[model samples]
Target chain A: MTAAVAEPGPTDAPLLRVRGLDKHFGPVQALYHVDLDLPSGKVTALCGDNGAGKSVLTKCIAGIYQPDHAEFLWEGHPAHIRSARDASRLGIETVYQDLALADNLDIVQNMFLGRERTSRGLLDEDSMERAAGETLASLRVTTVKSIRQPVASLSGGQRQSVAVAKAVMWNSKLVIMDEPTAALGVVQTKMVLDLIRRLRDRGLAVMVISHNLNDVFEVADRIAVMYLGRLVVQGDAATFDRQSVVEYMTTGAAGRPGGPRAKES
Target chain B: MAGALPERAPDLTAAPEAIAAELPPEVVAQSLGEYVRAYTARIRAGESGVLPVIVAMVAIMVVFEAISPNHVFLSPVNLVNLFQQSAVIMVLAMAEGFALVIGEIDLSVGFVGALGAAITVQLVQPLTTNWPWWAAILAGLFACAVFGAIQGTLVTRLRLPSFIVTLAGFLIANGLFLKVLLLGPFSGYPNLAGQSINLQVVYYLMWGSIDPVISWIGAAVVVIGLGLFMWLGDARRRSSGLVAPPVSLTLVKIGLIAVIAIVVVGICNTNRANLGTLEGVPWVIPIVLAVLGAWTVLLQRTTYGRYVYAIGGNPEATRRAGVNLAVVRTVAFTLCSFTAGVGMLLYASLLGGMSNNVQGGQYVLYAVAAAVIGGTSLFGGRGKPLHGILGGLVIGGIYNGMYLQGLSVEWEYIVTGLVLLAAVIIDSVSRRGSSSGSVTRV
Candidate 1:
């Protein structure tokens, strides 16, 4: 095991920097030498159509699958994460679109599912409830009427909030959310977008995978477009319009030349 | 411009608080009804939680008592008898609960229990006797433990379902039981008569009395200790910024325990006849209580307990959690079989000897029924050993009461089947309600 080296100085280096990452499933390549940097305190949107390899790249970073070849740079030094547990231990929490919340368990139980506190050799229900309440409150998730209510009773938007809060509760520096606003109503979508902004404002890096351009425009600070398992363009959110991103996402190259393409994109 | 905006609200309205206070009674009632609807909806969504099953159990008991004459069905002696008879069933149910908690089943409990008795008798008799009674008992238990471990390893390492593995065990164990029984019927075994062990030991444990004052003190101490542990634990957890059950819920649980203890003691103090004194706690009661405590702790308090629940809920999730699924699952099966072994020893003592042509299959079925009736989910990821005790007691009560009423054995079987079916149906309905509305959180 190599020693994990922290980057020098605060606000000096990107939280996560993936370089020359390649992944293959049998004969077909899923991700082709993808390179991207997720800086601290910003929401970076990874957008593409179906089969753009967004899910594949997200899973690799989340440690669900090991990349065939890649270097995961944490801070300024390369890091190796082999499992989801390892990623979690390194303060990287991923909230997949499914959320992975147990339906039978209530809000608090779901929030602390795997990492429950024990006192005197039993589940410390009081402590868990209080902590859950505090975490939800801190995240401004007030739509939930009761923490004791089962997660099944929660609406789609509330479930998303709970999933985010669960990740945030662990002091996660990098939170990856896969299509957080998918399959939600207009009101619910707005609530989730607000949550994304709140996560970034807390000085935490966020990587959001979404097909909804409206949501991307509302919350993302930076955009990375993937085409054919490779990031074709990367730039400030304010610099690119919807038409140019759509063009780049559908084609292998961006519309403009000598721009950020196939280099740092 | 003002018309287009529908005019801003006039400032002449009463304070906002006054407006809320003036809401209509019908509207408030409707809102209250909605709240209640939502609460019930949530409860219905979680399929395996405790409340719905508990309510059904109470309702069943009430209905039975109401339809019976003189409420004789609810008499103190009958209740005590119910507890006594349920002892074996409770032990067996707990054994099954352990297996079910890890999403498995133990089908060999009946034969395993018989095996324990057969071994105990053989060791204690003159034919092959070489050890004291205590040593023999320990040896019998050890043998069962080893047997359990073998079955567990087979299922875990070979990736076989426990149902199939234990079924095969059931056949092998029955053969062993028969072979051991035919080995010349060991003689001079303290109290052996033909094919039976002494009944005196069973009577002593089942109906023997302890000192009244001592029993009261013991019961009181237990209740107080439990209450203190719960209260203090809750407080400590709350202080540490963790989630805990409501304080009200804890108090309710403690109160229920106290009531149960006091009532049990009161029943034991009651005498059925003036000619013979029948007052005091039974030895088996304490033994069963001890077993319950130990097993409950094993399933709820240890890392092993977490692993079992995890495996039951989601094997994939547990695997991702870095738990060795095969090892934990096999250990659970082993424990289940070992407990069954203990139950068999006690059962033989109750009967005075191992009887020929024992229906091991029937007994195993009863054990499974007791567990399922007690609220343990067949699909796994939910259940506690405590359910075993409650379910066992209910079954035992029905058996004792029916026997007292001069019902035939066949009738008893029918009644047990019906009751088991009802309990299962209720469980299924409650589970459907709960799971549909909410996602099951670990």
Candidate 2:
């Protein structure tokens, strides 16, 4: 709960490192020994085909679903995240594919949905509006006409930006975005991708989930691919070519694991 | 998803400063006047403000005045009676509207109203326990809330359809209404209630009028309060550097309210009754207006109210925002029932008593109709408490006009049915126009 203007400090250490994460729903195993590492000041892309344990792993990290057997490491120390509130307390924020925005609410209201600033037992509109405006300005999202308009009235890209702003406004250490640019038009998609790169440059750990390989290679500094219910390949973006990443996603085969993608001049 | 845009790499060259500086042609607002123009354009685009309902109300009045036998519909006495009669239904409509905003319905509200009235009367009467007026009112509302909680729990926990859970509530409450009279309080009668609630406080609710001096003072306070709230909101928005509506627009709104208040007070100040000129605003008018103002503030300024609207729009999104869906939803039902209790007490004031044979089911339908007519959608996420007020007035005007015209209940039903259909049609068509505009670019 610092003022939303608090600057994020750069930390080269791994901000979050989850190892041997496993989750099961009745008879099906959603995540089987999934592992991920998100270092501060870096953008890590999680790439996988459908039902490839990417969402399962992100949800586990977000504490939406408790992992059956998982060890969460925060700054190289063991941590516990039992619920969504616990995840928030640990500064883990997730923007799901649905954008997780109430379409009926305005931009300011959506950005500070549950965490409204209250003074004198009423929502402090002035503070909330200023804070939301500042957050959007920092992200350079100026296309929206007014902060008072409903999310339902916003364009696809603006909606996604609002969702991302909501996630980052609350002193989050790691941001997990599930398909931040999906369902957006050409120009809007570019805006969101740029916003993601801005997040990494600001020294915040960003984990983006995407099926599009081009989007991954463009903004992602590191790439992690999952197959079936397990992490098969995890590395920096330069270590793997587009075809190899696809191969890893579908067939869980790659030259190596747990490093950067192959760099090309 | 991310890099699907072809211009991604080249676009990254633009600094955040440059990006922030770029404003699309439509969004470059240079003046408050432009903002006002844009506001009207948006309403024309089908995101209708309250103007449509207001227009419809005016039309109803015009039509009724022309067709009335003696042109008595415009009589000040009829106008006062219409608003007073509308008071109870308006409350019920507001109650039903809360549930509707969340895409739920409380069919039990009508009978809940009956039960509340029955409980209120039983409390003050000699046959049962005698409580003070305010306590009796609170106790009745408490019962209604508890009953609502039961139905809400069943729906939320068991994953039952709200329609079914509240339908069960409707039946159970009706039976309880009769049972309360028979075994609990009124053992003298095994059938319908021949009882009347003659408590002076309850009796004078609608019948009472404020002194002329107090009425003027009350009207001044109300006008000033409204002006202050609207001005404060606008000033805050302007100071924050967000787009605020023009000062001219705010002044226009304040002026409109001032005019309406003066007219209403002037009309009510006339001596309609022959008994030494009974005048000034009716007590029920202020009571209803106060509740409406409070409810409006709750929905527009409070966190709980915002969450209610958000949950109604998309439950999944609200839940993902770390809101407790079950609790908010359950509270919504409780609030609905609580308001229903308030409406029933108003009904008792109008009727001078509670009767077991009251038309509870039909009244619930009327409440829903009023909300819908006022612009609340059945699908939820788009509504306000003001809908109940406007819609209630519409209903009251129609009923009062027809009765004055000597129309039968059958004709009343036919006309009212058509109006409800028209309202629903407006809701659906407008919704489609606004939503489909974005999704279907082709």
**Maximum-DockQ candidate:** 2
Among these predictions, the greatest lDDT belongs to: 2
lDDT of 1: 0.74
Residue B431 in candidate 1, Cα distance off native in Å:
1.9
Candidate 1: deviation at residue A114, Å? 3.7
Q: Write the per-residue lDDT of candidate 2 for residues A1-265, one digit (tens) a residue.
A: 5453245433444889888888999999888887778888889999889988888888889888888999988776678999999899878899888887876677888998888899988888778877887888778777665666677667778888898889999988889999987787688789899999888888889999998777898899988888899887677777778878977887787655643442211
lDDT of 1 by residue, A1-265 (tens): 2253432434567889898999999999999998888999999999888999999999899899999999988877668988888888777898888786655456776777668788877776666777777778777887654566556557778889998999999878999999998878787788889998999999999999999898898899999999988888777888777877788789866677644555443
True contacts kept of each: 0.12, 0.37
The sequence of per-residue lDDT tens digits that candidate 1 reaches over residues B1-442 is 1101111231122232222222222111224454344344435443334554476557646765775566766777666766777888888888888887776888998898778767776666644553455666777777777788899999989888778888999999998887777666443223333322323333354556676677899899999999999999866754553434456556767899999889888887777445877777777778788888998887766667766877776676456545688888878887888888777776766665666666778878788888888888876867888888878877776677677667799988998898789767867776565443224433
Q: How far is B276's C-alpha from truth in model 1 (Å)?
A: 4.5
- After TM-score superposition, the amount by which residue A200's alpha carbon in candidate 2 deviates from its true location, in angstroms, is 0.5
DockQ of each: 0.30, 0.36
Reference-based TM-score of each model: 0.83, 0.90
Model 1 chain B weakest 10-residue run by lDDT: B1-10
